[model samples]
Target: MILVDSSVWIDYFKGVHNAQTEHLDALLDNPEEELAVADLVVFEVLRGFSSQRTKREAQTLLLTTQVVEIGGLDNALLATEHYRLLRQKGYTIASPIDVLLASYCITHGHDLLHRDADFDVMETLRGLRTWPH
Candidate 1:
């Protein structure tokens, strides 16, 4: 399964014409490709929409994908470890949320579909996989 990141989702919702959005559109059309989303990603995407109608629409669309539950303690520690390791390697991610998302993908053995550069850094620093293999 591929975890769709908020960065890609945001661009998609805005109807932005980009490679990442196009890839996501293709993935949505392909029945063989399984898409997933984390709670944090959902929140991040939905929270940006000020309109209730848009928020509902986004929620409905996101619900079609598998929602990966981010559990406590163990996952938090793992995220922290990932962040620490990356920082030690002289890599700085803009958000802790990105680390958590990468940790979730790593823990679940799922590929990530992201437009953000931070994921690229994680892919290099760690073994985080990105879609299109």
Candidate 2:
């Protein structure tokens, strides 16, 4: 399973051209690729849209894919551990949500699709798998 992060979803909805967005586009076209969005990602992406119509459009499209629940005490605990581990390795994750997202993917054994540099670091240091290798 590939969990699409808010970073890629935001850029995808805005039609921003980038490597990650392009990769997402390809994944959307492929029937074999299983893509899902975490609930936290949905919150992050939907709250950014100023227009109701645009938000509805994005919501409708996003809802077509499987929605993964990302909130739980277990996930939070794991996120804390991941944060502390990264900090001990001389890295500081900027967003609590990013740590949670990465930890969720790690524990669930799902690959992530993202445009954030922080996720890249998590991939390297914490074994967070990401799409496009």
TM-score of each: 0.95, 0.96
lDDT, candidate 2, 26-118, per-residue tens: 988888988898898899999999999999999998997889887899999999999999999999999888898899999999999998999
Span of 10 residues, lowest total lDDT, candidate 2: 62-71
Global lDDT of model 2: 0.92
Q: What's the lDDT of the predicted structure labeled candidate 1?
A: 0.90
| lDDT score of residue 8 within candidate 1 | 94
Against the true structure, candidate 2 reaches a TM-score of 0.96
Error of 2 at 77 (Å): 0.7
At residue 95, give the lDDT of candidate 1. 82
Query: What local lDDT score does residue 133 receive in model 1, on the 0 to 100 scale?
Result: 86
Q: Output the TM-score of candidate 1.
A: 0.95
Candidate 2: Cα lDDT at 92: 98
